[model samples]
Target chain A: MTIAATKQFCTFFVGGHYFGVPVLDVQEAIRYQEMTSVPLSSSVVSGLINLRGQIVVAFDLRRRLELPPRSDGAKPMNVVVRHLDGVVSLLVDEIDDVVETDEVTFEPAPATLKGVAREVILGAYKLKNRLLLVLDIEKVLSIEAITSGDGDDNAS
Target chain B: MTLVGELVLARNQVLQFSATQSDPALLSATQQLNLLTSELQESVMKTRMQPIGKLWSKFPRVVRDLAGICGKRVRVQMEGEDTELDKTIIEAIGDPLTHIIRNAIDHGIEEPAIRTRRGKPEEGKLSLKAFHEGGQVNIEISDDGAGINVEKVRAKVLKQGLISPEQLTRMSERELIQLIFLPGFSTAEQVTSVSGRGVGMDVVKTNIEKIGGSLDIHSELGKGSTIKIKIPLTLAIIPALVVTSDSCRYAIPQVSLLELVRLDSEIAFKSVENIHGAPVYRLRGKLLPLVYLSSVLNTGSAQLNQDVASIDIVVLQADKLQFGLVVESIKDTAEIVVKPLGHHLKSASVFAGSTIMGDGKVALILDVVGLAEHAGLASKVEAIAASNLAGIQNDSTEGEKLLLVGVGDNSIAIHLSTVARLEEFPASAIESAGGRPVVQYRHGILPLVDLADFTGGYSAFSQNESPFQVVVCSGPHGIMGLIVDRIIDVVQENIQIQLIGERHGFIGSSIIHNKMTDLLDVHAVISSIDPSFFDEMKEALIGGVR
Candidate 1:
């Protein structure tokens, strides 16, 4: 009679997401071709990419999980992983493959979750019937949330 | 003193010549002091003379010991004693060429009966020459009599308010003898010790520019004063150009090199111009402004549209001020060597030493007037207040009809720095600069500005293959050319950048073959293309040619 139960998740769909990032935080996945924009950066980054040659940045993460605008047309896919000392890629709206098993498959995050995509998800995976959620991509690739409020420029 | 007492009396005339002879005229004065000590050992292996005429032969023996203590006669002529320099430039032109030949023989050679009514004759002529011109080394120094009196230099260029008797009646008797070299100044009329305590001609142009050199003075009223002096030929070999920006690489000097264009990716977005975000460059016809060596250091770049399509401006020049650096290419001119940078980098005024380069690496050099006085740039009224804070304006964008697009991924193009040519426009029409609509884009108003904030932003477009343009970016702080959506095939590729995040405002991601490419801050997009774009324009853009 020993059971605490409560952990089990696998979700995917980045930037429109069923969301769930942590099949051991990825590490390898490649698709986007040339990406290299970072000039005077900080507008949610979406720039530097070259995974195999190793420069990596590609951030968008659905504008870091405000989570609506995704298939601008689909061909860009990088995903890579790691971050910090190096390796970053995030852009995603496509690589859906891995799905192991977890803590009774999470559920405790409902109360409107505080906003800005609730800092990018932490618990929810109903599955079978279909809810998923979870994802936290290192606090959604952090840098104080891609330069926060951008001092102003949503205008477009 | 007499060449170290004639080298100990020519080694005591060869040790009192022991030919052990019976006084053949004291051994012919010791064989003419062994032929004057072998012509002072072949005049110390011929040429490069110094001891500047033994410091102007101790000033004609202190002007014949001050014309016998100021009864006055002075006569001193000495031309640049074989102009050899560096023994700390003959100990810095030996006391300002001896307080300018004792202020031209104590107040310009007058007495001898006031030089026979100032037609000047009684012993006047004091001289000194020192040549090697242009790459600097001059020395001049003249004198005749009286001179110094343009109504006492327009009453001392108007009692030192430094001009305005309508600028001393619009100066130029050689700018009225360079208003007697400013600093404290003195038209004499009294206070003397040989010269007024106003420390004569601004300490003779501050000790001939403390050895870097530049002093000018030319008087003529009663005809006399000349003082020239220029310096720089080798404080250790300089020459430079190297450049790289953000991933750092700097050097720039070919004595302020003047050319190195390159702009490729179809001329770096048609040569760049933003006016309202400042970054202009109409160039040959005039509108130049644009800086970005990485906005003084903010560093950035991981990718920014694969360097917007070719870049490498350079241009330099200094003295009258002529800017353009914009690099990521130009590499080689190096005669380098220099070294300095120590005393805690002599006040980091943007460096001027640390050379090494032929692959040995080091690099540093730049000072471009301490990086245009540390990027506030210094003048054309601080470059039209940094081109009206990089928004630049001469009425073009308002007159509308602007077209400079270049966005790749799916692709977008059109660039014309001023092409009376290259006009295609239909990526199915395109529209964004103001018809905005979440930008599926199309139908006119082509030109754009976000070149990562025009010239002084995107972390200073870090350059290597440097490029950036959220919009069409003309050049030099206004509109020079930067419409690029891919021309990424120029084949001379050879870079490295990738430091990873954080340093991304100027340089930290550029490695080509192993692959990483984001380095475009170009001084935060030329300071966001302009705040008013150098104003004074109810009329300039058409100068770039309608």
Candidate 2:
């Protein structure tokens, strides 16, 4: 049998879930910076952060994924990613190592996984330690999905 | 270009860091870096600058083809072809410029035969002139052809029911000519394949304004029309006024900023009054509407310093409507590089974009027009200024200028021509004389009439400790004060009395500002209060004649 091609992904953690975005899509990951709150924006839009000199909108992945609020005083790290519109930073609980997986262990997202996770999660790679969820970065950052139903559940 | 922007920001950070250092060598090096960075930035920006002639080079052919289609003989001329503009601005203005050229050939220029009959050259002259003035690029497109017909524009506006004939009469000829820029307004008696679907000029105006530019038109009846556009040198950077509200900073573009007014605690309390829940300030005899930035943004902050010891008002003009924006404080003005907001926050229309301040913090930029719309002030102002088109008509003789006032729940209009001045008298200063209320005025006793008594409405002065809003007018007897609950607005409207006087003091009722406003008969109201008020004046005049 022929061996499957390997794909690399930059990994991060939010709400106990391990997520991976294609390595090429990741711009950089840095410590949390001061954010200017947008008063009337969607709940998932954490705020605007100064990335070098560029103003990047920060999205809270916990709320975006419908998870409980982060513990008090725990600052989220920014996972800056290139978007078609501009650069946006996804606030995650912690950063993980880049993971490489082959198509042999890949499985499409289960039909039973419902709600927003069903939409943003492309598939999973069964790693030796745990399962790595491959995130569809485009769908995750799309403005329409971020603002539609269940988006405003935890905004306040 | 973005890399250059990043370099400039890095240099700024380094300069800021070196400011606290006492080392002379390091300080000198930082200064050298700052100066060199500025020079380098300027050089990089110059690389993007192209002579505007690059865009106009193809206009002659456009003019030729368009003139051929219109069956007109036109000569195209260009001046200042070497004048330069940013590449982006050159690209942005291309379509609008071409549209203007097409409009000139199609509608502006008369045919060759008509040009000869007018005793002029057989060919019409179409000139495009470009120059730099006041740190802006000025482009003028002029055509020596049949000029804009003010009469035609007025007739079209009337036919479309965009304005009433009465309002049309009050509009000046220049204002009538400008009506062509209104959306869906086309004066091309016939819709030709070329330019006159009524969509070009309005879009042209909006496109120019989007880049911090302004468009103006000057046309003569038979001479021609000149469309002049003034655009900023670049759109990447703009001068903005920084302000704070709810402890957060925001930037307002200087192009929309008219002026800044700071009112002391006492003046603020007295000058800012509430009219039907909307706060308005009497600015130099004009009623300027006020919008609180914190309230509009719903920042969850305590409502606008309720006790407002002092206030800062940023007077801004949005879409020709001027309003005062109340903020916590006014910071210094700075030239900021504008950056776009992410798609997540794009629906928040109040913010034009976000910018990084010198301290490396992101501050949202306020979109004046959007903010006004969000506050619901734009539509309100548009309704109140329905005849705003006649705002430029300073001729009071054309229409009756009325001072609209609120008396209880009713609105009343008093002829502004008869008003001597508007005065606010303390309620404590009121004294009674022969069962009539009066106040001591400029060394003489000025009789006061309660408008509520005439209209049978509740008196505001009697309920509160607030001062009486007195409209001072001079009759044959002398100046008398008419006490009203609140002073609404001064508008120049054609009074078409729809209902005759149904009450004692009201002359009649008319639909003013889309409301049934009673026209107050000042003489009758004064006579109802004091029968001898005008009789005494008559006795004095007869004595003088004898």
Candidate 3:
């Protein structure tokens, strides 16, 4: 049997679903900061945030996933990550701990997933209590996909 | 460098925090930190600069090869090779400079036989010079060869049907030479491999302008041509004016800023007028088109609020068009470090980039040209102004052209040949010298003549805040300014003077442009202002003191 390699992921929650991205790709997680809204941008672009003097465009994960809107008065956390061009922040409901899992527990993404989840979910990792959906950050942050959607929802 | 920018921002934040603290120790430390951070930022910026010689090193070979192909003899000479520019600008200018050099050799320089026949040296000289001027870099490429032929350009323009014969006759020689920069315009007898594929000069102009540089050409009939380019030193940092609209702050680059005007509610209501639906303000004697920032950005319909206590206008120049941008409030000016936006937001034409404010918030920087395009004002206003002038010019062409001015309720015309220039001066700039209103102009004193007061019309001269619209005229004594209420239109039509009763400051009355216009005797008006003015000037001239 081949030696089992372990991979670590920084996890977060959005619309009651567990999601994780490779730990190396994650920059940092911070509390909700004030955002300066862009007027005519796409719907998924929540606004721009100042992360210690660096301007980072924040994308709302709930809207990107086509899930139900978060309830009123609930502040979203910022999950900053590195991209090919620059740094971007993903707004999620809550932050979770970094989890380590063996490669043996990894499995291909199931065919049952629908909507945008099927496009951005790479695969899954079977944990002791539940399944952790692995997010493809490149596909999730695709410039073409973000700009080509029907921009109707107002994030402001 | 980005880390240095972040440090600068952090230091700014610290300075702001220290403003609230009264402790001497912390305040002194913050001041020291601010000084050190600024020095460090300057040092880092210097490291990014490289000598422009690095980019020009390969041009001699290019010139040699191009000269050989065209059967011309050209020698390359470069000056100020050590002139330093930002590394990015050095890289960006390489191709455009090469293209200009190629054109100088291929089109500007004459062949060896032609140069010998014209009594010029067989070897044509191509010189590249660079220097620093007015806080910017200037590069000039000149060649001593056959210059642009204005007659040939005019014929080519007509052959291409670019303009009508009447319009062509109206164009000056310099304007005709500028037609070479038009797209798909070439005066070459035949297309050659080295240049003249009908795509050279226009692309060169566009590429240079993209980097905030301007290109101008000067040529004589056979002396040669020189192309001068002026560009800013660096693009990483710029001074910008900050303003708020719908509570969102935006930064406008200071390069495009002309002046700021603040109008109180009372004056704003009377001064700002609407023509067809576009709002315009009478600045001096000219009509300035006004653009509302709120409506352009779609932030909110804040422009419809007629109860605003005051109006703040930021005059901006975008390309050849100048318009006033109305914002909600004016904030302080700051030196901002530019950062590019993410790729997803690149399609938004209005925003140039994003910058971090002193308060650690992100603010969007506006691209003036893109904003003008998005608002659909650049072409529309130009078309309207052009059509208005064209309609008047097409009406008549028989009599002398006259400048029409409005004095209170009367329209008066002055011979265009006698008018020196039109100028506008603020009311505050008018000072009293020897009990006469005079202003310092061109290193001399220009006396003011109030036409309204002279003609015994309704005198609005008491308002010290409104600017004076003056028509400058050269009298036998000196230059004098005739202050009028506004300037109407210029029309050329046969004069049929209807001699009315002798009126002060009026020679006779005539019907022009369907209005009763009085022909003003300029000499008589000047003499009436100060009877001794002409005598003093004549004495000075005779004494050889002038």
Q: Could you report the DockQ of all the candidates, in the order they appear?
A: 0.01, 0.46, 0.59
Worst 10 residues of 1 chain B by lDDT: B410-419
For model 2, state the Cα shift of residue B358 in Å.
1.5
lDDT of 1 by residue, B1-546 (tens): 223323533343354443656787767776776666556633542333354566676778877776666677767777757666555567766887788777777777677778877666777777877777656677787888777776776786577676668757755466576677777777667785567666777777767754545577677767777777766654544457677765546677676567877677866666676554556566643566667666544454422245455777787755456777676666666445455443223345556655444333345667676666566554342445456567633333122121322233311112222223223233333333322211222332234433333223333222323333334344444432333443332112334445665642344444432344454544444444453443322123345345
Of 1 and 2, the candidate ahead on TM-score is: 2
Estimate, for each residue in B1-546, the C-alpha lDDT of model 3 and write its tens digit: 777777877787788789899999999999999999889988877998888888889999999999999999999999999988888888888888999899889889999999999999999999999999755789999999898889999998889887799988977677687788888888888888877688878888877765656677899878999989876677677788999988999999887788999999988978887765678776643567888998887777745467988999999877567888999999989778877788878877778788888888889988787788778785457554665576524334367778999888888898887799998888898987656787767877788888887567885765758887889998877788888888886667678888898987778999877888889889888878677864654564467554
Per-candidate RMSD vs. true structure? 37.0, 13.1, 8.9
Question: What does the lDDT come to for candidate 3?
Answer: 0.84
Q: How well does each candidate superpose onto the true structure, as a TM-score? A: 0.23, 0.65, 0.69
Model 2 chain A: lowest-lDDT 10 consecutive positions: A147-156
How many pairs in model 1 have backbone atoms within 3 A of each other, for residues 3 or more apart or on separate chains, i.e. clashes? 135
| TM-scores of chain B alone in all candidate structures, in the order given | 0.27, 0.58, 0.61
Candidate 2 residue lDDT tens string, B16-111: 688788999999999999899789878977998999989999999989898888898899999999988988889899999999999999999999
By TM-score, is 2 or 3 better? 3
* Candidate 2 vs candidate 3, DockQ winner: 3
> What is candidate 3's CA lDDT for residue A61?
93
Number of clashes recorded per candidate = 135, 0, 0
